[model samples]
Target chain A: MAKKPELDDFRVPFFDDKGKPAKFSPGEFDPGAKPFSSGTKEGDRERLAVIGALLDGLQERLHAQRVRRVLLVLQGMDTSGKDGTIRAVFREVDPLGLRIVPFKAPTPVEAAHDFLWRVHAQAPAAGELTIFNRSHYEDVLVPAVLGDIDADECARRYRHIREFEALLADSGTTLIKCMLHISKDEQKKRLQARIDDPTKHWKFDVADLDARKLWDKYQNAYQDALAATSTDYAPWYVIPADSKTHRNLMIAELLLRAFEGLKLEFPPAKDSLKGLKIE
Target chain B: MAKKPELDDFRVPFFDDKGKPAKFSPGEFDPGAKPFSSGTKEGDRERLAVIGALLDGLQERLHAQRVRRVLLVLQGMDTSGKDGTIRAVFREVDPLGLRIVPFKAPTPVEAAHDFLWRVHAQAPAAGELTIFNRSHYEDVLVPAVLGDIDADECARRYRHIREFEALLADSGTTLIKCMLHISKDEQKKRLQARIDDPTKHWKFDVADLDARKLWDKYQNAYQDALAATSTDYAPWYVIPADSKTHRNLMIAELLLRAFEGLKLEFPPAKDSLKGLKIE
Candidate 1:
């Protein structure tokens, strides 16, 4: 029998200590692969539900302890499943403890400050779980692909991202980042489907299609950003996202492992309240 | 044939044009009433699912039109189901279109500013749906009930809230406020349940019982605040919340009616993109 698949196999290698540019390519992984699925849709969904329940309990314990934080960063292209992944994986968790921040185009105020300023303000506090939909990685990916920043400048931003993540890690936060990977062919189908339906027209803008024209550039930018920023304190995983069920399950499995690794426990019982009665 | 229970019947009478306060009291409503239920738990759930689906579509149109906003404010005493109502009513809506804000005891920085400052910063933008788990109403209820502010001061703060809500309404935002009403006996049972379970201890505070001792005062403060602030643009509804399903269903029904009244439509098709194909 083939060896059981491991999550680390998909992790971008840790950045080299010598400050050399690390090399990796998005094209090396097939988007259609389902390395973590249970071989059937029903089975995959059942597995996801199981993981969701465990996540709910773990999140409760995290909140009860009130001493640790968890941050999950999701980055993907337009047609990838960042929103779907958040809805599916967190369906069972209490909304009180889960904070979802969707970062869009920078406003004038945000653009005035250093790129990390707005992001730092939203860092998860103790006993909270935060999900960043399309995070600061966009800073590196967009400017580089548009030729607004040179290679050295992009590398410098990558280092800043690594250091910022390290700051969060040092402050009792566990960070997990994923780049949802999808094929160009899948992009064509999604865009075509939206265009064929008039109801979906609002989600489309003519300028939105301009990104597909620069697909290869964006992919290469992602490759450089992932290779340079993946570190010991914060790691990036490439999620194969062509199969929606498989994508949800793999991400769910990854998160459950990260949370369980925290070994979260509820705060100890209070001795003074052993026999306390409500008046 | 029996008459239907119009949601408007439970609405706090709109503030009079002369600004005379209404004389209604929270004690007039029964916590165990289910005026909106379909007479069985399963029936109420089915009704809720129907309303949830309609709400999902209305929210999509609200986002597409990008012209109007919806804000739902939920305030209740301990264990009266503010969090539960949000989780249930929004279970089917796309998370992309919804934002949930939970206000806790103000921090030093927040308390430094005027009460409405932090709240104004979170008002819903055009084409969005926002929910406040607890809201500005707390400023009146908690302070007045605790004797931290005199009745006259509480009334003055109520006027400030009315003005602030009018500002939002003038900017094309629709506001719906619900006060979850539960009996003191129900609250006692719920608090006792939390105390009995060690796992739920973190959610309990010794100071919580002190508030229970002042339940009648809180009820009176709620009565005064609701009568003073309810208006044509922003109305307050009393929700009988002892039955969780009934509370969820009734709120879902009320929200659907408010959303449908807006008559939202998707933006017109762009003639420039008529039949354009992506490269």
Candidate 2:
């Protein structure tokens, strides 16, 4: 029998500090695999809800303590279920404690500054749980895949990204990054469905098809980027996302495990309120 | 028999633009009133859920259109349930479509600028629904109640608020402001509960009791601020909040009504995607 799959099995291998980076291939992962599913769609959803409730309580404790920060970075190809994962995974989490930042194509002002400028401004503060829908990773991925940046420039951006994320981690930010891995055939189906349904046209752009044509190029770019930046402080996980329910379940489980590892608890009771009575 | 309660029944009489401002008194409204309640806590929660689902759909259409903006401002005394309202009312809305900005005491940088300077930066952008939990109103209420700002400066801030809101309204933003009104006795019980429960002590502060002692003064300040700043463009409503259920219900209903009035719908299907087939 095949060995049971673990969350670690999907993590991009750690970058070698001794000048020999580990090899990673996005094509090696099967997007249609259900490694983390609970067997049935209904069972997967039930498990997801259980994890969601756990996450919700943990988030409240995080806010009460007000000493830690969390950043979840989500990067995926078009229609690979990035938005759906957030809406599903965080359905039970308090919106008050959650901040979602979606980064689209850079505005003129944004492009004028260093790539990390806008992302740095959106980093999670103490006691915050922030999710970046699309993030600074785009700065490296888009330009590299489009041939606008040479290998040296792409490598430099990766080094900067690692250094910037280290600064955040040193200041007490826990980061989790995921790449929603999907197959090229699945993309064709999703894009075709959007085209068939007029109501969804507003979400569909012809430009997305142009990107789809460069599917192999994007996959290669992601493989390189993930290999370079998957560090101990900020690791990247490849999620098989052909099954939406399985994708949500895997991500929720991953996040829940990360938060539990933090062992967060409410702050100690205040001495000033020990014997006080409201008048 | 008394007349049926309408959401408008709670709105502060509009501030007259021509010379004479309207007369309004916060003390006149009963903080314990449940005019919008469903007569039972269970029923009220059900109604809130119904409105929540409706608001969720309306919010998606608003995002799809990407042409309009919505801002909800929540203000109240320390324990008036600003956080609770946000958590309960938006439980069903997509976190992607919602942004919650909690304005605590201004930082040194923020305080150095004019009062509205920080607020102007956070106004909702197009295709967004933003909520301000304890908003710019604090700038007016706090200084006035402490006697730090004289009558002239207080009046000037109100005018500035009016003009700022007018600018937002003219630019296609829909604004809804609510003041969660809790009575003194109810606040006493809530504070005592927090004090008695050591686990919740983190959320309590000794300074809250000091503010409670000046309850009447805060009421007067709120009354004056609401009266002077309540214009047709951005009106303020008093939400009876002694019962948490009724408070959530009323605010949800008010927002649903406001959103429905916009008649927001998904943008028309894309012409470029009309008959294209994905290959």
Candidate 3:
């Protein structure tokens, strides 16, 4: 039997694709890596089915245990397959125990309160699985690069988020953050596809290009934020997201490993039910 | 081509295996209708798959329209298949566009504010779909029967809910509310199943029994709530949910009908990308 791999062993292929060592300084890093191919061969469908069955079992165990909630945060650039990864991995799980919260721009009420207020309300209850499509990390990544807020405020939020997640961990929530790292070329292709296909044109936002222009700055912010915040309790997993299949599999594997480590047990049946007549 | 079925022709079934009909007002009603089994055969997986495809198509159309929002409100008794319907119908949807918000007991913050505050915060954005596993109907149903609030308060909330939904409709958000109806015996069987199966024991909440004792009161509350709130803009679809398969298909068909009415047009692509270079 193969030994279980450590969480750190999860490969992030961005640096290798650039043919140079990637640096994480207080400044920008040039974009690297091509789109990762989803290794969906002919038999891949069968494998996914098997994985789906396993997921059902895992979900049951998690619910039965009534343990701490599990929060899976997926962050990525456009077309990074955040949506696709979530659907494929969690497709078989029971909806009762699963919660998906996608954070968009702050509304008037949300803007009035702290940035984390809306997010806090959406956290999962016990024995549930919550997925955040884009999370509080945006306070650091987007605002820092867009100059929407000052650098000092961004730095302050980075510290606040680390503490916020640590508190959730202490309160029985397992936070697993995944950054779907896609390449610039892949993003361009996807954006073009959205424009070319009338059915997909609604997904294309012209404003996203403004962020693309400052992509290097955003990369620096992400690197700084990850380094500052990834803790033993709530670590970041940077998946090679260029390939939708690979990203989905990697996420599923990460989740499987997390649940496996929790050692969840099913609650025993109440004996009183034996007297109840089903007929 | 088959003729379109009349809305009145949709009759849901109920059952009285344990002779529990004596507990409620006397009326000649089919207790063993099992209305959910209409289009699908017994024990067929295709029912769920077909619903899943319809949900996926609806999601795609909803997204392509750039219509930021859609809301699915599910209200049901125990074993009414709220969880099953949501899972089966939305199993294949893009998670980015979907958000499932389950309303439970009020938290400290929720209690501090008005009831609608928390719910309004979770409303879907443009190009998104939001599901309320249980929702603001509690403001009327629980209070009306339990007398936690007076009749005037309940009546006021009924009007408020209608106005709220109307506001959502006017804002271009499609609101779909479903009430899952199940017989008392079916509820008992489902509750018993939760207690009998060790794997499902965790879902057996003691509070559920308290609600079961007030089953008739709840039915009355539901009838009143639906009658008062169902509007042309956001009509209620009271689905027969005794069979999980039937509930899934019916809900999916309703969703398909809703999306089909949108007549979503994809945005035209700009030719400006012709000069963009990918190095």
Q: Evaluated with DockQ, which candidate comes out highest? A: 2
Off by over 4 Å in 1: A19-21
Quickly count the clashes in candidate 1: 0
Fraction of the reference Cα-Cα interface contacts (below 8 Å) that each candidate reproduces: 0.30, 0.84, 0.49
- Order the candidate numbers by DockQ, best to worst: 2, 1, 3
Interface DockQ per candidate: 0.55, 0.80, 0.37
Clashing pairs in 1: none
Interface RMSD of each: 1.7, 1.2, 3.5
Q: What is the lDDT of residue B138 in candidate 2?
A: 96
**Candidate rank order under TM-score:** 2, 1, 3
Per-residue accuracy of model 1 over B183-277 as CA lDDT, tens digit each: 99888788778778887788877877777899989898899999998999999999999999999999999999999899988887776567877
Tens digits of per-residue lDDT, candidate 1, A114-178, equal 99999999999999999999999999999999999998899789889988999999999999999
Top candidate on TM-score is 2
Order the candidate numbers by lDDT, best to worst. 2, 1, 3
Over B1-279, each residue of candidate 2 has an lDDT whose tens digit, in order, gives 989999999999999878756888888899999998767899999988999999999999999998889999999998889999999999999899998999999999999999999999999999899999988999999999999999999999999999999999999999999999999999988889889998898898798787899999999999999999998889999999998999999999989999999999888888899889887
TM-score for predicted model 1 compared with the true structure: 0.97
Relative to the unseen true structure, what is the C-alpha lDDT of residue A185 in candidate 2, on a scale of 0 to 100?
Answer: 89
Lowest summed lDDT over 10 consecutive residues: which window, candidate 2 chain A?
A: A13-22
TM-score of each: 0.97, 0.98, 0.78
